[model samples]
Target: MATSYRVGIVGCGSIAQRHTKAYQSVPGFHLAAATEPNTETSRAFQETFAIPKMYADPIEMLQKESLDVVSICTWHGLHAPQTLMAAEHGARAVLCEKPMAVSLDEADQMIAACQASGTKLAIGHQRRFYPGWTEARRLISEGAVGKPTMVTGYVVDGLLNTGSHVIDGMRYVLGDPQPEWVMGAVERKTNRWERDVPIEDCCLGLTNFAGGAQALLQVDLTAYSSADHFTVQGSEGLLMVAPDSLRLISPDNSNGETLPTLWDTHTQSAAGSVGFESYFHIAYTAQAQGLRAWLDGEAGYRSEGTQTRHSVEIMMALYQSVREGEVMRLPLEEGAYPLSAMVAENKLPLRYPEKYDIRDPQRRTWIHREAYDRMRADGLSHPEIMATLFNK
Candidate 1:
């Protein structure tokens, strides 16, 4: 093998910047090239990172760059086609951002393309690399929580945004059990979009895992949004989990047990891991390190596509449940995104009528990015962030 491998980035947004820093932190990965259609954004990204080549055309970059690793950091709808393109271009591995794709069909296409091309496909559920999460998984499996019967995961934004992590995290702690069925509800009173894809205004559902445990999913269902959390209720105890923190509460102790975060567990070893940021910076590095080992012939990568496909299916099935007006079973028969279909059929007409994107600077409803960053650094949850924004 070569001493180092070439890595290309498909987008130059904030997430892509993080991915660039992570690739730089990990050994044996070089930031060889990148493509961004937005000229100003691409220039800013290139200014911050030392990527040698830039392309306005993604296809041009894919054709010209002999990249071994490709990071697909585009919008939700672009994931599958971009992933298939990367695979077709001989990239050995791809770490595409979450929600994977708009529908199970696109997800299937990505999985099949990668499988056929012999490329390692990993979905960006990097929270799987969180130390607290892994610890919770170990404890749950060893019965520390004892006979987990129910798990409740909550997130804001849309189901495909932070909700994907919530679903994947809940399953991860419970040892990635199979979800058998789901009954869901959604409210889309207006035309709402997240990162250029249609999304429900709010949604909630109950999914029965094949492992005798049930999970309640809440996505944008409340005004009080927090860091997406997974609370597991076992026979012996209850556990509350976030990407960076874990809490264990047993029968005798109401105070609960505090668990290690990256800050707690790897202070000495990971001083250098926080290259561009802290907190999640460590998690991203760990994920990249895991990817490195997996690419070097490890048995499994935690967020592989086939595994992530189940989570996507669960979400899709949830939407389908609302679309069909009944509970939905797994292996969803619907190939298109149900939410988008509803929008297309005018099943969800804009009651308020103006379109808005919560992440867009031009959109006033979206929290200001600077304030969002500042509050997050101050340890504010999503609920607090929104409350603060609304109070003003």
Candidate 2:
């Protein structure tokens, strides 16, 4: 019989629920506990999911439960600390939420803790597990697109908050090439919320990768629709993927005849069209499967922690560029700039809903203060953070 891995989840927030559902759908895994700081929320999560245990504190749950793996579903800032704690608790592996940490340093600490503890860590870049993305990566790796030259990613939201997915997804499809440098601009057009939050509403970044492939990313919260758009341009063809469809164009015709080029004569006609055979909203499901495979010692399973760390490094570089008002080189060194500097300099803006005030320390500190402190204490300095987070 295949051994059933015991799993515990920390943070009973919205995403945690999704993780619970995914676990339930997979075999050879058991959802042992769900923990949250708030007793009410924890209890509610337990009741809603029929989980066997619920704890008000994640640390307590980690110490008490005989879990083989723990899911760090806390706020964006708590990912690293909770993951470190999980590693220390003898868990075989940990699955953390995105962005890994607010700062590069924190991300490093989490990775180091896992490494030291002999526990595996996987970051939740669930989109990579999606069928469309999986297919796209397959095609790219098989040279379907032929030496990708450039990629354009548009994620209509803040860079740190939501842009991490776009950035990570880019790395996933591009074969995790080392970044050369980042040049970007950020904008915060509206301030309709509370004062203390430190997030940006829109950003545009240009990056050069080691393979000479250039990437352009645009993120905006003010976009007209709630859809994502991505395009990859290769030497021979172009590929476009969106929320609803995926299209591939290459330069060869079935009859071996040169096809008519549109727009630019230099562009060659491409071939091949593949669509989603079975329409399934399985992003979260695939993530769960990947997590299980990693814990089961399945070869070739990409750990989530690795992806999260890289995403953190890329975003940090972009943020650094925006702050310094110059192109920031890759592999940022330690103590480059404190998270406090980013907040104090007003380089990182907070974009909240109309109901919340950005100025409230408690409210604004979710992504900045709380997350940074946990990361810093874990022994991750800026450069170290970038190295670990971005290291492929």
Candidate 3:
């Protein structure tokens, strides 16, 4: 029998509940403790999970518990810092929530700290375990899609918020190729919600792969509902994949009948009844499987930090591309977040009036200097910088 791994969760939000349930389901894993800033939620989570210990602060929980595995399911900005803390506490494995971190530098720091501390760092890109997506990848590798020349996909939400899922899913299906470049555009006029995690109103981007494949992505924050769908095309076959279903189109049908596009449909469902909740179960199972494999020394976690950092970079490059009105290359220069810098540059639409007026002489100079540096770092031309400064 495998030895049990003691687990602790750093956040008590909705996603953390799923992680708690998943920990319980996985053999040789124990959800022993949790931490949350909110007392009411902390108490409730403790009661619900029967976790023996709970703390209002994550660092305190780490200091008190002898935990082997730590799950950081906090906000986008907190992932890196919390993971670093968990690693410092000697966690053998740290599973951080998606989008990795708000900036590339933070992602690098998390990876470095975990590597130095011998902690296995994984990101919460759980769709890697979806059976339909896995099947689609298999068929494509087996030439079902015959080389996968291009992919067109759409996500029903904002770019960094929900589009992270779409981007990571495509990266997985493409066998995790190195991204070459991205040419993109975004609108921040709408999608008034999600201020906590600022995102684009709508986004359209094309990311090219080093292996000569490309993916075109569209995300509309105003979409009716959340969705994950993609149509992959190749020389000989095609594939349509979503969260719950997979359809394959090939020239040589099993029936051997000649048709323009002969599709074979495959539907997926949970072991029990199927519904919206089923997707969460699937995600949790995948997380558990990854944890178990890494613990057993069987393989590296699929959504490991190094791999997820690429997605974060891609997401940032998309915004950088929009800001510069040109394609942005891979391995974006590290510093402040591109999205935040874009907002500072007044490149995206603002929902409300400026809270603080920069008209004060000192503040105006500082703000203008910051904008100039950001635009320069992005490689904007002098004329363009003048236009930005004078246009407003």
Count clashing pairs, candidate 1. Answer: 1
Residue 124 displacement in candidate 3 (angstroms): 0.7
Using Cα atoms with residue i matched to residue i, what is each candidate's TM-score against the true structure? 0.90, 0.78, 0.82
Whose TM-score is greatest here?
1
Candidate 2 TM-score, true structure as reference: 0.78
Q: State which candidate, 2 or 3, has the greater TM-score.
A: 3
Name the weakest run of 10 consecutive residues (lDDT summed) in model 2: 263-272
Best to worst by TM-score, what's the order?
Answer: 1, 3, 2
Q: Single out the weakest 10-residue window by summed lDDT for candidate 3.
A: 261-270
Top lDDT prediction, candidate number: 1
Q: Per-residue lDDT of 1-392 in model 1, one digit per residue for the tens? A: 76687899998998997788888877888899999999999888888897898999888998998888899999888899999999999889999999899899999999999999999999999888877788889889999788999998767788889888888888888999998998988888655678888787778988888878888888765545544467899999999887677899998767998877654453225427344446577777777777788888889988999999988999999989988888898768999899888777877776555576766656745556788668756756544565575567
Winner on lDDT (2 vs 3): 3
Clashing pairs in 1: 225-383
| lDDT of every predicted structure (CA atoms) | 0.83, 0.67, 0.75
**lDDT tens digits, residues 1-392, model 3?**
34999999998988898777777766778888898988999989999889998888888888888889999988777888899999999999998888788888898999999999999998887777776676677777788778889887776436666778878888888888999999888766432334255665567889998888898887762233234668788888778876556777777753322223211121122222335677657667667766777978977778899999888888888888888888998878845677777877787755533332212243334237788668756756333443476567
Residue pairs with backbone atoms closer than 3 Å in model 3 (clashes): none
Worst 10-residue lDDT window, candidate 1? 262-271
